[model samples]
Target: MSGRAENMIQLIDVSKEYKMADSCRVALQHINLTISEGEYIGILGLNQSGKSTLARLLNGLLKPTTGQVLINGMATDSPQEIRQIRQLLGMVFQNPDNQLICPVVEEEIAFGPENLGLPPEEVNKRVDWALELVGMQEMRYHAPHLLSGGQKQKVALASVLAMQPRYLVLDEPTSMLDPLSRREILEHLCRINQENHITIILISHHPEDLLDAKRLILLHEGSIYMQGTPKEVFKDMEKLKAIGLKRPGLYQLIQQVEEEGYRIDDNIKTIPQLVEMICRI
Candidate 1:
């Protein structure tokens, strides 16, 4: 945890509710959180646990019913500051099909910068840079619809990266992809966080996806159920199961090996680590 880092996003006593003719449903309840700049934070929850709602609030796509959401010290509720807030924070959704607007990949990547009224030369530069960043430079002129699921997702991510946002909020960006694609997207995001110093707020249901995050936040029934380092949070199997979540496959395997009288270290998170530990035994 980087305690010395400054806060980039803050939620203070925030709550969100949707009103219906018959009843009002609360999506979030009195939540308070602070996300520092350059931090990789993963949000974990089951469906309808307010994960998507929280992402929208962070980027000002949805307003909080109560309290406040502040991005870089600017209030999300302020209409005048909304544009600036959005420019500083980029959001990618679960469906790449919905996010891909332009027919061509390069055009889609340039859309955000073009909207900002950047010069043509600047827009072209950004498009090229974003394509390279996502390892999609060869697909620049390709049609988005003709690409694979992972490629489309990479194009969508390139579009967001083109804007050069200081913070990126992803809501289940890998949910619709194949297993290999999911791993590729996660690896790219990890690189973006480490090399670019961009703050990442990733919402995911996969236990393995949360392992690399500096902090993991678990939401249950519209409230924060747990918050801690990945190891600290996932080690509590009983609590996670009660909240409808599961431990990572690696963790479960390690536990089973320990039960078989093998002195495996409980903290091993990767296959290489496990193999190295077993060799020492």
Candidate 2:
């Protein structure tokens, strides 16, 4: 798919600083960005980088120390603006346990719309649609505690979807999940973005997490390191390694093309895609 959509988020020269006991910490600097609706985006960085800080800024959880953060053309700091923007932007944190407060699946999904004082019928309709969208319809009555990590994440996704948010911000949603659960969550996110027309802004360290995103934005200390398609970002293997990121194992095969001195287009991004590309060559 083309890496373009309706512009849903815009951060104009945004900066953030936090005051500590003796000193101030600079979390981010002059970061400007725009997110389009239905576009799958990944933010990659090492631990303690400004990835989470940016996520918070998106939903107005933290105000920028300088510059402006705009959502759907309105500045985020205005109380009236934020209240309206927040309804269109929903966030999911690293742990599903923290986000899931209700005991049952249906109630959790209905919580957001219910708070808006939506009619009971409308709320129920949204809950049912969100549950089925995340493939959790069968488990609607199941207790949240009984769900596996992957299932819980799906329910978390359902909760966000239930709010009918146009944009979804996930701050390392799969960080605590097992490999299987991680894949499951990632797959659901891909399907959600594609089928539901929901914009996705994800922050993660895992390269696998970038698989479904059309573009990857690398953040260091508090700056944009690079931004491009996954294949474009992975092309510079040494640059990625220098920044504490690694390309997939298939990247080794791609590098071999240079060793053999061939000018072939080895822009394959995924292992399966790489295998097929090589076989076709």
| Tens-digit lDDT string for candidate 1 (121-219) | 999999988898789999999999999999999999999999999999999999999989998899899899999999999999887877779899999
What are the per-model numbers of colliding residue pairs? 0, 0
In candidate 1, residue 60 scores what lDDT? Answer: 91
The per-residue C-alpha lDDT of model 1 at residue 211 equals 75
lDDT of each: 0.89, 0.85
Tell me the TM-score of model 2: 0.92
